[model samples]
Target: MSVNNIHEWDKGEYNITTDIKKIDRTAVHSYLTRSTWAKGIDFETVSYSIDNSLNFGLFHREEQIGFARLITDHATFAYLCDVYVLEEYQGRKLSNFLMSCIHEHPVFSKVRRLMLFTLTAPWLYAKYGYEPVNQQNYAWTILRKDMYL
Candidate 1:
């Protein structure tokens, strides 16, 4: 599949899609502002980020219930972030399906390295072959925690 093609997957009534137009920016911004890591983040910043990244949206019918994004060069590296499923939708294994779509997307087909920093749900990621960056030199980050506040 072409990297420019919109990718989609279905599970019962839910679906995951890589169509940027399907992402609900207001819902994403609302969830992120309440999240510990991105608390107080502004809409413009969120909008810009969404515009540039490869975003995945999980939906129940037409309502957006979850989201994730990859910042990538679409070949050598990708950083996964902003992954979440709404609290009301938590028990359905949608996250698993969402991750599956990300891995199967064309943008990630030639990725030599995929990275993510998660303060929660490491088990969820582990199920998909994501491992802790065990050695110190594997990553160096300049985190601006709560920067928007």
Candidate 2:
């Protein structure tokens, strides 16, 4: 089916399955490259990571158009990352739909503290209750390369 036809699905049109079986690595690489924030990611590395990470892909007629992933321990903290919608498919609120899926997914629902960072689209993320954190007030330490490497 064409994207246009899929886009016309009622709010509940296509089934939002959590199975990542249909994920398109090529499309994901394209989207990540377009995302700009993912500049240094090697496609092979990204493919490997996606294969192992807790991730989701939004499909319209079996074509992956949007993607997101979470880093979590399944109990305490979850960090959302690499959320992206293909440029051609933007403005259709697919990102929001994808987020809703992630929020309602069984594996992610119990996460206590969810965090994400974005250089753009703060408004979109804020609509989902994410806020900028004050780094200075937070207790954290940065490790220098000499210490760990």
Candidate 3:
């Protein structure tokens, strides 16, 4: 029961890692609570989610600055969610670097589908081959917007 699927990338002073141990739970929960999609989420729920998911964290030197998570089985499907870079950290292409690490992950080779929900950064995702769900018959969700509130 060891979850050790980690990948890391370094560019100058910025680094991205998938080692869940490196995640700063307090920083992540603070950000998600204020995010449009996850506002008012409690620390316990956020902690539980991180404990269960494959997480990617971005850091500057040693301080956590950004984060993302993949809810996946590591075999069939993956849902990318809760991705973000702090406002001060944006404009540095760290998001692109984050996506690169995710796309290059070996687990994806066996994954049949990847999905994500975003109300922002569509252009950034588009560059990595994500597109609007076929809208006709391919995409759907039973979205409970306030499920955690």
Candidate 4:
């Protein structure tokens, strides 16, 4: 789907926006480089992913403080990833605000399967109705643990 306009939600001085132009690539790359999940990921790859995905950028004043990328076709499925608030900004409920904006966004309404990979915060995702998958899953994954090495 073509992006016809920008989307934004605000809380006091903090806001989250869907305007890709407002995203700070350098800041995001800097955070992700030290992040456990996207560690060692290249800047080119980060830029490419942002360009292709439906991204939500979290901001304080004019600074990019957090980001989340949703890889979706806007109908059936979406993979939410790279979600975070800056270290100094955590515990301020900014992530909850970000997720609220994402939940209210139109793109996710028709999606049947929404999934995210996070080993750190189950409680956070649980508030959004995401639960742990039990049962013997037969799905296979081709993990490249050393791909960036």
Error of 1 at 17 (Å): 1.0
Which portions of model 2 show Cα errors greater than 4 Å?
A: 1-16, 139-149
Per-model C-alpha lDDT, please? 0.91, 0.70, 0.89, 0.89
Best by lDDT: 1
The reply for model 3, stretches above 4 Å from the true place, is 1-4
Tell me each candidate's TM-score.
Answer: 0.94, 0.78, 0.93, 0.94
| lDDT of candidate model 4 versus the reference | 0.89
Give the number of colliding residue pairs in candidate 4. 0
Residue 8 of model 1 has an lDDT of 83
Q: What tens-digit string does per-residue lDDT give for candidate 2 at 1-149?
A: 12421111224443344454656888888777656567645688678868776777777766777788887887888889999877787898888887777776655668888888778789888888888888786845463423211
Q: Using lDDT as the measure, name the better of candidate 3 and candidate 4.
A: 3
Candidate 4 runs further than 4 Å off:
1-3
Steric collisions counted per model: 0, 0, 0, 0
For TM-score, the strongest prediction is 1
**What would you estimate as the lDDT of candidate 1?**
0.91
* Candidate 3 colliding pairs: none
**For model 1, how many clashes?**
0
lDDT of 4 by residue, 84-114 (tens): 8999999999989989888888887889989
Give the range of the ten consecutive residues with the poorest summed lDDT in model 3: 1-10
**Model 4: lowest-lDDT 10 consecutive positions:** 132-141
Residue-wise lDDT of candidate 1 within 42-143, one digit each (tens)? 999999999999999999999999999999988799999999999999988888889989989877788999999999999999999999988978689898
